[model samples]
Target: MGGSTPTFGFPRELRILSSREYRHVFDSACFKVHGKGLLALACPNDVGHVRVGLVFSKKNARRAVDRNLLKRLTRESIRLQQHRLPAVDIVVLSRRGVLELDRQTLARQLHGMWRRLEKDVKRAADAKTSA
Candidate 1:
């Protein structure tokens, strides 16, 4: 476990309800990369802070307990790498394998996904600046 409390965690930080704010992101969000257990979607938001929407659908991960656990692990991974990410709303969609993966595997998968997203975000930002 991390020594310091993680800033990007559930109840305290994640956003998951269906609303107009979410719809705004849904239409604009672009998906960058996907791995066995995860898919990352990025959307530019008007808010100053980055918001996360984590989904572990019942159709994929059956048990509520298992789904919650996977969400928590993904949350921690994001919290640790929060500094490297851009200021965009990120949604991580979870798969069944996510529940079974080891901590290292989970971290590595998420980190790789984050890295991909960062690259795309930066490239787009640069294109806008150059244009």
Candidate 2:
């Protein structure tokens, strides 16, 4: 390589790794952003950056390919939008209709969800500060 290249890698530190971590977010979700075929629950974390967990259950997507595709899209969306997100652990759950959506539609939906999530977090912060 001639010049230094930008690394667009999704590192392990940015993932909600263990069952305990997932349970914490589930039990005490600070906020949720709903989108077509998906629901994202998030709780504030002290990690100083956003971390993501994806739940594409077999009940929702019967095919392994469909589940994997959704997971990849979710992870890529999070990686791109991480800097704009608050310090929170987010778990994105897929619904039954998710597999019906085409890739582009799904990507757009994920993008919108991230935008909504950012807005919601900012609003909460503002409310906290004003109180």
Candidate 3:
């Protein structure tokens, strides 16, 4: 067995902590990618690392369990694709139909959203540098 297996976890540095940080992302997201069950918003950050925030409003997902499940799925998706993500704060919002979707569908949607988020961040950064 490997003595020191490479660890993979969502560290605090990679999470959008604090109410102010969440408010900032909610109030001023530069770009977004819309999916059937989710909406991902992205904005460049000075932290120089990709940070993720999950938002599952009670209005959208009624049950507490459902909300928690959505949060888990979102975090797992980010963990898997964090390497390909850029230095931006991404907030994922769950839609009304999110609970109805199966795990595979949710994963697929998350994957697509992540890809779009990456492209949007790159495009925005390029535009800023050019201007």
Shift in Å, residue 33, candidate 2: 0.7
**Model 2: runs farther than 4 Å from truth?**
1-7
Ranking by lDDT: 2, 3, 1
| Residue 100 lDDT, candidate 1, scale 0-100 | 70
Q: Output the number of the lDDT-best candidate.
A: 2
Better of 1 and 3 by TM-score: 3
**Model 2 quality (TM-score):** 0.93
Once fitted onto the true fold, the runs of candidate 3 whose alpha carbons sit more than 4 angstroms away are 1-7
lDDT of 3: 0.87
What lDDT tens digits, residue by residue, belong to model 1 across residues 30-130? Answer: 65568777887778766555567777899778989878877877888777777677778887787657667777898789889888888888898899899
Q: What is the lDDT of residue 45 in candidate 2?
A: 96
Q: After superposition, how far is residue 36 of candidate 3 from its true place, in Å?
A: 0.7
Between candidates 1 and 3, the lDDT winner = 3
Q: What's the TM-score of each model vs. the native?
A: 0.80, 0.93, 0.89
In angstroms, the error of model 1 at 77 is 1.2
Worst 10 residues of 2 by lDDT: 1-10
Tell me how far the alpha carbon of residue 57 in candidate 2 is from the true structure, in angstroms, after superposition: 0.6
Clash totals, every prediction = 0, 0, 0
In order, the Cα lDDT scores of the candidates are: 0.74, 0.92, 0.87
